[model samples]
Target: MGVVIPLEENKNKHASVKPLVDLTKPGMERVNQLILSKAGSDVQMIPEVANHLISSGGKRLRPMLTLASAALFDYQGDADVKLATSVEFMHTATLLHDDVVDESDLRRGKSTARMIWGNQASVLVGDFLLGQAFRMMVDVGSLEALDVLSTAATVIAEGEVLQLSVAKNMETTEDDYLQVIRAKTAALFAAAAEVGPIVAKADKAGRNALKSYGMNLGLAFQLVDDALDYGGKSADLGKNTGDDFREGKITLPVILSYRRGTPAERAFWREAIEGGKSDDAQLEKAMGLITKYSGLSDTIARAVHYGEMARDALAPLPESDWKAALMEVIDFCIERAN
Candidate 1:
């Protein structure tokens, strides 16, 4: 299973998510209740499928961001809870849909919902979660928050499609891959962080700050995952190591390795990735190529760059346990994985 973020690698014991978890715990309790309530359905299989993934080992960091973002402004209301629940449902829905699309067998070290329930069921449950997410948003009665999340929903779909467009294509550039991640992974993070300030009626600058912070954090988080796919073990990712290669995902490491490779190495990538023939030996070779070309290290460097951007984005926000906790998140995302 993927080691949870804030793993044992944290040398900066001070740099932990404990503060964020503690700060959001009270609010998160309510978010959990909303998640359980909304995930229910008269049809038994719906709840079963939903619960399978929902109870999996995810940290629910996105919704925590919503709670902490609101806490940053000291807003005392329940709307943020509903919004947080919405964010989680959106996240869960995407995971279900993603497993189906990627044909992934494992998630969080458990059998994927698609693996157990079948793709049709996973897709249907994901759609149901999206519907429930919109309902929760409507309950919050914030049009701007609604717009942000709704746009995220649309953008995430676009990102999935964009990823599919570029999948296994060695020609995919860094920009194309970055755009896909911005939409698929970062869009919800941006939405989850922005909605807190919106519901709290914070200043425009604060909302923008959180949004930018989340966007950069999301980028950093995914880049680390990209590097981990090649550089780390299965325990680090929860899924099998080199699943990206098996799935033919043209992530940053692949892009970098492809671009920096010799003509023969490039042909190997074409045969292994674009042609979809990667096996254990080829995966090892690919890892070596990524290392030989500094793809893994450079990917981590990009993650660090974005991590810095995420911290800088929060610099103007009022200092509080909330802000400091959020700052720690930037490092935890990098250090825990690296």
Candidate 2:
């Protein structure tokens, strides 16, 4: 939950995401309480760690997506709250594991779970959270819920493996990159959005609309994430600006830069990605090439493309404020810092 990007940086880097709250609504307050209650508990050590991360304060995007999707279908069940929490729990579990895997030191401006707790504890507690998410789904009592979560979990694992396998490989293609995004980042988002309608037993068209919305929004979010990693405040991004280079992770901007660069620039990228150590000088040179190629702009366009697709995906749903809120969330994905 890295949270130290200065307000100036966020404002300078881009515009703020439009606010979506309809403060007059009762469901919104209930949803917030539900999220808080679901994250509450008595397991001192694990829950403490969980609470530390949860309270570090993200925008609570996943749970919001779940609630919004349910609202689109006019669902009034208490199960939506539980399901939203379940989605957040699953998302948090992935973040814990990801921090350990990435050897990440900071998240949202706070120490990573792996940095605070031992690796073993982090892994085990993450597993515990994952199980709790599943238990919550079971309590929701929908087979569709089980199917969506199980599939999302499987894809997340696959994405992790895919990323690991291709790490530092200069030849990683755009299609391959999208595959990894779909697996790692988008899977849970898709599930979070789709499950609401599924639980409410919405018709096929509505379910598909929500699923498409989540999938596109997730892709857009990850694209922006990769772009920001190269050209963002380290405090805002939670990871170092050149971390992808340091860790040998080949993201879209880097790949595109490599493709568009001069012979020396291409060689530099090859060496950097393939076990070359980069100091500030080399990092600056690499960033210069990325800028020359307008890689950031290209990445933003891609993100915008997905954002539009996400918005278009909502066409089948009946018009409602919740659907509008979901659209705003997608806008936030492309525009948010930290």
Candidate 3:
């Protein structure tokens, strides 16, 4: 059976999401209603699987960015709500597909939809969500918004393929890993934030600022998640710790540890990571090596660097509560390490 990590325990740690959540409450309420309405279908199974994951515990950060970005420009129309819903559907679809590709048993401390309903169902429902997302995008009638989101979808698919190419390969470079996350994780963030300004008809500078903020924020977010897999509690991570190690998936910490370790240490990594010799004992040894080499700390440092970049991206934007809330988000992302 998969482990269940209760989210309530981490409430204090995740307060960064609170301000944005409160600020976007009205907009998000509309997005939530649309999400449920659009998720329904005659097929029954489609909504079953889609709602299973949708109702599961996720912060819905991407969609909030869309809502908040539009709110920044004081957008009064309902377009932002639809766009926010679209961003969420895109994110949910990606999660379903990702669990299948990773063969993961747990997500947000619950059995994955694939594990419960099977891979075929998960994939098909993910496709359904993607379709619904595009329909919403088209309904908004912004060619530029549609183009940005469609481009992000293409980039996300390419990023998934890129990750598969590098999986279990210890020699994956930092540059290669960065490229993968930039596309797979950050692309939607960029699009979600950029679409806000687009819908509000903001100038190019405003659009570009939000784009930069989302992209850098996403990089920081993923980097911290990678670090958490090695050092965090199951409750904090929403999955068992060392799942990455057991999966033989090479993340930044493993790459750093492998690159910096001694000859015998490198062999150990090769045996454990590439050779798939992961076990409880091997995981313990792996943790030792990671700690000895400061892999986790270094990864956090890199996250801090990107967090700073995200902060800088917002420097030119006029001050507002939404902007302050976004800035707090950057601090929250980096502070999750504590």
Compare the candidates by TM-score and give the number of the best one. Answer: 1
**Which ten-residue region of model 1 has the weakest summed lDDT?**
1-10
Please estimate how well model 3 matches the true structure, expressed as its whole-model Cα lDDT: 0.89
Question: Model 2, 229-258: lDDT tens per residue?
Answer: 878887677767887777788789898998
- Tens digit per residue, CA lDDT, model 1, 201-273: 9999999999999999999999998888887777668899899999999999899999999999999999999
Which 10 residues in a row give candidate 2 its minimum summed lDDT? 1-10
Q: Evaluate model 2: give its lDDT.
A: 0.79
Error of 2 at 277 (Å): 0.9
- Model 2 Cα shift for residue 33 (angstroms): 4.8
Models ranked on lDDT: 1, 3, 2
TM-score of each: 0.96, 0.90, 0.95
RMSD of 3: 4.4
Stretches > 4 Å off in candidate 2: 1-43
State in Å the error of residue 265, model 3.
Answer: 0.8
TM-score of 3: 0.95
Clashing pairs in 1: 1-238, 2-237, 2-238
Clashing pairs in 3: none
RMSD, every candidate, angstroms: 2.9, 4.4, 4.4
